[model samples]
Each structure stands twice: as structure tokens, then as C-alpha cells.
Target chain A: MDLFISLFINGLATGMLIFLLAAGLTLIFGLMDVLNFAHGGLFVWGAYSGIFVYTWSGSFIVGILGAIVTGFVLGWITEKLIITPVYGNHVQQILITLGFMLVLSECIKVVFGPNSIPVDVPSYLAGSWEIGEVIVIKYRIFIIVIGLVIFGIFQYVLKKTKIGLIVRAGVMDKEMVQVLGINIKRVFLFVFMTGSAMAAFGGMLMAPYSGVIYAEMGMEYAILGFIVVVIGGMGSFSGSLMAAILVGLAGSFMAYYVPYLSLAVNMILMAIVLIFRPQGLFTNAKEG
Target chain B: MRHEKYFSLKNLTFLIIIIALIFFPYVADSRTLTILMTQIFIFSILAMSYDILLGYTGIVSFGHAMFFGIGAYTTAILLSTYNNTMMIFLISIIVGMIFAGIVSFLVGLLTLRLKSHFFAMLTLAISGLFLVVAEKWRTVTKGNDGFTFRAPDVFRDRVIFYFFVLVCLVVVFLVLRRFVNSPLGKVLIAVRENEQRTRSLGFRTLHYKVTASVVAGVVASLSGSLYAISLRFVNTSVMSMDITLDALLMTIIGGVGTLIGPIVGSLVIETAQHYLSGLANDYPIFERWIIFFGMLYILAVIFFPKGIVGTVYVKYLTWKSKKAKPQLPTQSVPLVKDKERFE
Candidate 1:
């Protein structure tokens, strides 16, 4: 029972990290109609920046904040330079974004050097909470709480705020929103920044969980985030949540039970999802 | 005109080019001969395969390497464990084709419901998922250990692989050329230009897409088999997004619609890669193939949207017209001659 409890918590924590990354990805796709393959690059950049700041400043919170800011700047520049030109053409977007993914990843090696850095849990979140025979790490619970909070805050902002409404509106009909005299491009810039920041935040949070930050970590988790987005349906927020959870649980369970297909399990899940429901589980948003 | 084909200059030019390609390999040095021929055979097959999805069906796939990798891996594993290359080739080709078809069949069934953009993203995601799995699953794949075969025999070496590829490329090319010229090809073209219109044409467009997709899978598998045999190894690199992008770029650079385009595209690209790397070794200042190739790609897409072959073919036609009427103007005559110097 304790083992079961441990596995469940571990899976939940991983799922939250994946959710944070996937949330950003789905939001970008939902609103922009651009599939940023470099999304993983952002996640990795977040990890490196967050970890660097954490080590230099000796403050975990400050490290995370710095990471988000870094992601925002990168996102703004990337949007202006790379993504802005290839809006309507999927092929061009893919080519350019993929190139950016490689460049961004390589830049991580340049900035941080080609070594994985160890990041320890902050003292405040270092302990474990025991419930009868079950023990849960304090940081895992913290991750879950943080994940829930981010989801809640974003959900509330999306549901009750004008900015959220505009984003949702943009997702549904960019032209219609443009007709109403709103600068959809600015909105895109804003969403792109927010999404990048969110991914960075996820990476910052993931550093301690994985116990190390490597340049390739972004590619690794970015793939998981992508599968979640696909299974959850592209651009569907609630769908991302459900899909992330499903993939998380499946990954956790399958790793122990069917070890051979462990890596392939997620792929199989995605393939099956694509086969049965290709538009994804949620495609209700009307977009042109 | 003595023949219907001769009535059209394009067909006549195509015939001439085909005849030249067959003869040029004989005159080239061994290294250049093998490399260029391999590029033509491999990329022509890949481009033809890609056309099944891109040109004919209008579905742009960012992950076509999944089939290619699967084919290569299956063949490498079989060939390493067994001796009969023919049987292994047959099994791997079938497996790769079937697996790809099944995956696409399922993916297409679902994604075909979405818009083209969403569907394309889904394919990209699926291939990426495959890459991650291939990389991490260290047991069967030896993870990244990557299996290599013993150099089989001299007669069973590069030349042998070259011949094998030649036969496959010609067969696949002719079959597809015929298919596209047939009623089936019209259905595919119709689907691409207008999906709803094709559907309203009382055709099950989904079935046509699935069929084209499988054909593409089979052809890609053929290249994969040759790649595995020639390189004497099979690894996840075959399935990586880079190779898939190369195939996409090859098709894009060559022009997607024509049979000759990918062949030309691959010839330009692989040669670029070979020469670029060679240049990198000679001049350390130009070490970055990434920047160099990226610039070339950007220029091609931005300035010459028609692709290398398509744009050149257009230029050739314009020149032909001017050459036929050298009486037009000496100024125009110089321009035609100058342009001919470049192609």
C-alpha cells in the first residue's frame, strides 16, 4: 500500500510538470494556429535559466521568476523574428520552428556548458509527510498544489476576465475579433509570452523533481507535453488537464507492469487516440 | 509530330533527361558515380513516396521518417540475425508498409476529420512520439547502441546496393507515374485541390488517402532497406525528425508535383551536404553547415517558390522560346545564353 501510494505521488508530480508544459503548448496552438516545435526549447531554456538563477541567487522563488522573465524575452524575440513571418504556412512554420528548436537547444549548451546540473530541493520543501503507512514527499505535494493553483488562476482569469475572453475569442475567430478593432497580433504576442513563461515555470519546477537539469531535458519533456496536447486535443485547456492525467497514470502504471513497452506505451496511447479521435478529444473551439 | 509525347516540349525534355541520367553514371568516377546514383535512387523513391501524401493528397507530413526508420530497423535486425537478404527485404518492406498503413489508417481516420493544419500537426506529433520511444527503449533497439552488419561481400557491396536501388526506384517510379496518369491519380489530384469537391464527386476520398499513404510507406521502406544495407547499420537516427525534414525539404526543393523533381532535389541537397561538409573540412571558417544550408533554404523558399527543378524548368522553357527565335533581339539572346550558363 505504501509502495502504491509512493508510485501514485511520483506519477502525479510528473504529470503536473507535463501539464504545465502541455498547457502552454495547447494555448499557443489553440490561439495562433502555429505548431511551435521549439516549444521544448523554451522548456529547456526555462530549466537552465531557472536552475542558474537558483544557484547564483540562493533563492528558489527568485530563480523561477527569473526563468519566466527569460522565457518571455525569448518568446517575444522568437515571435518577432521567426514565427511572425510564417503565420499561414504550416510547412514554413515547421521548418523555421524546428530550426529554432535546434538553435535554442544548442544555445543552452553554449550558455550553461554541456553538463547536467544538480538541483536540490529547497530546505522549506525538503521534508516528507506521513499518512499512516504511506509517506509522501513534501515537494511532490507542493508541485501538485502549484499545478492546481496555476490551473485555477488561469481558469478564473480565462472565465471572468476581459483578457481571457479576448484570448478565447481569438481562438474561436481571429478575423471576427480583428473586425472588432482589437489587435489580434498583440494578443498573439501576449499569449506567446504567457505560454513561454508558463513552460519556463514548469521547467523551473521540474528541476528539483528530476534532480538535474540537462540541455536535452527540454526535448525529453517537450515530447511528453506534445503527446499530452495531442491526446487532450490541440488547444483544449481542460482537455490538456485530462490528457495529462491519463498519460501520467498510463506511464506510471505501464512502467512497472509492462516494462518492455514502457517507452512505447505513451506512443501507443497517442497512436490509438489519433486513430480513433484524430481532431483530438476536444475540438469545440471554432477557429478559421 | 511523329509521337503524341513529342507534340509537347515538356514530355520531350523529360525523356531526354531520363536518357541522360541513365548514361551519366557510366562516365562519372567511382565515388561520384556511386554517391550521385545513390542520391538519385534513394531520394527519387523518397520524393515519390512523399508525393503520395504531399502533392497528390495534399497532406503535409512532418514525420514520414517513421516508416523509413521502421523499414530500416526491421531489415537491419533481420539481416543481422539471418542471411537471406531477399527474404529479409520482403519481410521488412511488408512490415514497414503495413505498420505505416495501420498507423496512418488510424491517424487519417481521426485526423481527416480535422482541418489540414491540425492533421499535419498530429502527424508531426506522432513521429516525434516514435522518436522518443525509439531513443529510450534501449533493449530491442540497443537504445542508441545501434546495430551494424558485417560488410557482406564486395560484389554484394555498394554497386550491388546501387543496382538494387536502381531497380526499386525505376519500378516504384513507373508504377506511380502510371497511377498518377490513370483514373486513380486524377482522384488524388482532385482530393488535393478540393477535398469536399472530391467527396461530392461520389468518391470515398478517405480510402484514396489511405491507399496513397500506404504506397508512400512501401516506397520509403524500399529506401530504408537500401540504407540499412549500404550503411550496414540501423539506428533511431533513421527515425529522427532530421531525416524526415530532409525528405520534406527534398520534395519541397525539387518541386512536389512532378516525377523528376525529388530526384533533382535530392541530387542538389545530398550533394550540397557532401560538398558543404567537405568545404567545412577544407575551410574551418565555413564549418557551420546549419547556417549555410538554412540560408540557402530561406532564399529558395522566399525568392524561388517554384523549387529548384520547377523554377529551372520554367527558365528552360523561356530560354527555349528565345533560342527558337534568335531573331527576336541580340539582348534577349545574351540573356538566354547567360541563363543557360547557370543551369
Candidate 2:
């Protein structure tokens, strides 16, 4: 029972990180119909930059803030430069974004040097609590709390705000929204930027969780984010959350029980989902 | 009428090129040049197979390396485990191709029903699964360190092997040319242009796609076998994403739909890679060749979207039309109508 709870918490924390990345990917796909493969590049950058600031300033909050700023800036640049030209063409978008992904990864090697960097949990978030044979890591609990808070905040904003309604409307029909006099283009830019920022924020949090950050981690986690997006259903926020948790739990348990299958478990789960429910676990909000 | 002529100018040009390449090993005598040419031939075959999916059928699969790896591993395992006789070498290629065909067929059936982005991501994930399997099944694959094996005596001779691979490249190219021009190929093209319209026309698009996938898989496996033979070694790197990206780059940079374009693209890229890496020995900055490669890729997509051959062909057509005398309105009307109907 203790092992199960510990595994469950671990999975939840990992799922939250994946959700941060997939939420942005699904939203960008749903609203703009643009699949940004370079979203992963934004993630690695967030980790590198956030960790750099954390070490320099010695404040975790400042590090998170730095990461968000970097995300917004990179998001704006990607949308304006790399993404703007290849809009509406899926093949070009995939190729161009893939190219950008390579550039981003290589640039990391250039900037941060070609070595993995180890990170430590913040002082406040270190250690664990033991409650009668049930021990809980503080960092893991902290991550779960942060993930839920972010989820709650985004959920509220998406449901209650005027921009949220506009974004949702844009997802359903960009032309209809445009005809109604909303600058759907600006909304697209906003969504793209926000999605990218979230990816970076996820990367920042993932650094301490993983303990080591490398240039290639972006591609690795990006694949996970893509799987989560597919399983959650593209453009569905809650779907991403549900699917992320499921993948996290599956991975967490499988690693402990069947080490040989851990690497392939996510792929098998995705294939099964693809074969049976091609629309993903939850249909897109727009479609639903 | 031009195509009907057996000895047309185009046909003659191709024949001359083939004859020249056949005599290349004798004339070059340099081992480095021969090796380079052989590498180009092998990759040209791989890129052309990719074109069948990406250009001819409008399907973008990111997991193409899986087929390549299957072929490489099959041949590598067979030759090392058994005797390296000529018969085994021949049988290994066939067996590898069959294995690749089955896997690709299954993969296509499972994933082709999804949208493009979903299909791409699924294939990538599946290929990653193959990589994991290869890594974990270290006893058979020898793990990431890989294993080297001897080939048949005939293949041990570089000159003989070079010609053999050249012949394979030529044969594969001609077969693919005929494939993309066949009626079935035309239907594939129709599907690419507009899947819904083709479906409305009563063509089973899925069947056509699966067929293309199988053909591509078999051809890619053949190249993988050839690659393993050329190196006398096999490794999990054969199935890496880098190999798939190379195919994609070759197809796009040469000319997507043009069968000959991938050959040209492979030549340009392989030569550039060779020179850049060679330069890396002297210049520290050149060590990061992939960064330059990535930049070139981005530039190619933005500037030469049609690729070298495609852009040149379009230009030649426009120039020829400009030079020709204007057609009478009555005559041009039928021509325009014919073109519209054909399209």
C-alpha cells in the first residue's frame, strides 16, 4: 500500500509536467491548426535558462520568473519568424519546425556546452515526510501542488475570461470569429506564445525533478508531450490533463514492475489508443 | 509522342549517364572516390523510396529508418550467425525485404487512418519502439557497440561490390520510375491531390497507401542491406532518426515528385557532408556541422521550396513557352481545355 501510494504520487507529479507541455501543444493545434514540432526547443531553453538564473540569483522564484520571460520572448520570436511563413501548410510546418528543433538543440550545445548539468531541489522543497511507514517527498508534493494550481488557474481563465471565449470560438471556426471582428490573428499569436511559455515552464520544473538536464532531453520529453497530446485529443485542455496523468502513472508503475517494458509501455498505450479511439480519449472541445 | 520514342533525347541522356557510371570504378581508380560514389548510390535508393511516400503519395512518415534498420539487422545477423556464402547473401536481402514489407504493411494499416500530424507522431513513436527493442535485445543485435561480419568473397572485393551496388541503384530507379507512371501510380497521385475527391471517385485510398508503404519499405530494406554489406558492420544507428531525416532532406532538396531528384539531392548533400566533416579536422568551428546543416535545411525550405530540379524544370518550361510563337486562340482553346480535363 505504501509503495503504491508513493508510485501514485510520483506518477501524478510527472503527469503534471507532461500536462504543462501538452496543454500548449494541443491549444496551438486546436486554435491555429499549426503543429509546432519546435515546441520542444522552447522546453529545453526554459530548463537551461531557468536553471542558469536559479544558480545565479539563488532564488527559485526568480528562476521561475526568468524562465517565463524567456518562454514569452522565444514564443514571440518563433511565432513571428519561423511559424509565420509556413502557416496553413502542414508539411512545410512539420519540416520547418523540425529544422528549427535541430537548430534549437544544437544551439543549446553551443551555448551551454555539450554536457549534462545536474540540478538540486530548492532548500525549502528538499527532503520528505514520514507518516507511519508512508513517506512522501516534499519536492514531489510541491510539484503536484504547483501543477494543480496552474491547472486551476488556467481552467478558470479559459472558462471565465473574454479572451478565453474568443480563443475557444477561434478554435471552432477561425473564419467565423474573424468575420465577427475579432483579430483572430492576434489571438493566434497570443495562443502560440502562451503555449510556448507553458512548455518552457514545464521544462523549468522538470530540471529539478530529473536532477540532470541535457540538450537532448527536449526531444525525448517532446515525444512524450506529443503522445500525451494524441492520447488526450488535440485541442482539449482537460483531455491533456487526464491523458498526462494516465501516462505518468503507467510509466511510474511499469518502471518498477517491468523494467524491460518501461521504454515501450507509452508507445504500446499510444498505439492502442490510436487504433481504438483515433480521436483520442477525450474529443476536442470544439468538436464535442 | 516524345515519350513514345524509345530512343528519345531524355532516354539517350540517361543511357549515357548509366554507361559512364558503369565505367567509373575503372577510370577513377581512387578508393576514396569509389567509396563516395557507392555511398551516394545507396542513399539515392533510400531517398527515392522516401519520395514514393512523401512526394508521390503525400504521406510523410518519420519512422522510415525502422525498415532500413530491419534490413540491416536481418542481413547482419544472418551473415554473422551463418556462413557468408554468396547464396546466404542473396537470401538475406530477400528475407530482410520480406520482413520490412510485413512490418510496414501492419504499420500502415494501423496508422494511415489518422490525420497527417497523428500519423507522423505515431510512426515516430513506433520507430522509437524498434530502437528500444534493438537496444534491449543486445544478444542478437550486439547492442549499441554493434558487430562486424565478413561478406561473401565477391563482395569483399570493393570494385566488384561497387558495381553490384550501382546496378542495384539503377534497377531500383528504373522500377520506381515505371511505378510512379503506372495507372495505380496515377491513382496514388490523385489521392495525394485530394483524398476526399479520390474517395468520391471510388478509389480505395487506404489500399493504395498501404501498397506504397510496402513498396517503399521493401526498397528501403534493400538499401539497408546494401549499406550493411558496404560497411561490413551493423549497428542500431541504422534505425536512428538521423537516417530518416537524411532521406527527407534528400527527397526535398532534390525534387519531391521527380524520380531523378533524390539522386541529385543525395549527391549534393553527401558531398557537402564529406567536405564539411573533412574540414572539421582543421577548424574547430566546422566541428558543429549539424548546425550548418540545420541552417541549410531551414533556408532550403524557405527559398527553394520546389527544390533544384523542380525549380529548373519550371523555369525551362516557362522559357520554352515564351520562345514559341503564340498559338491561335482556337487552337489554344482546345489545349487549355485538354489540360484542365487532364488535371
Best by TM-score: 2
Which portions of model 2 show Cα errors greater than 4 Å? A284-288, B325-343
Question: Which lDDT values do the candidates have, in the order given?
Answer: 0.76, 0.88
The TM-scores of all predictions, comma-separated, are: 0.82, 0.95
True contacts kept of 1: 0.13
Candidate 1: interface RMSD equals 10.3
lDDT string for model 2 (B1-343, tens) is 1155888888999999999999999999899889999999999999999989988888889999999999999999999999999899889999999999999999999999887888899999999999999988999998899999999988877889999999999899989988988998888887777788999999999999999999999999999999999999998999998899999888888877778889999998898888888997898666677888788778777777667777787666666666886433221100001112101
DockQ of each: 0.17, 0.48
Model 1 C-alpha lDDT per residue in residues B126-196, reported as the tens digit of each score: 77767767787777676677878753454255566666677787778878888877788778877776678
DockQ score of candidate 2? 0.48
* TM-score result, candidate 1: 0.82
Chain B TM-score for the candidates in order: 0.82, 0.93
Among the numbered candidates, top lDDT falls to 2
TM-score of chain A of each: 0.96, 0.98
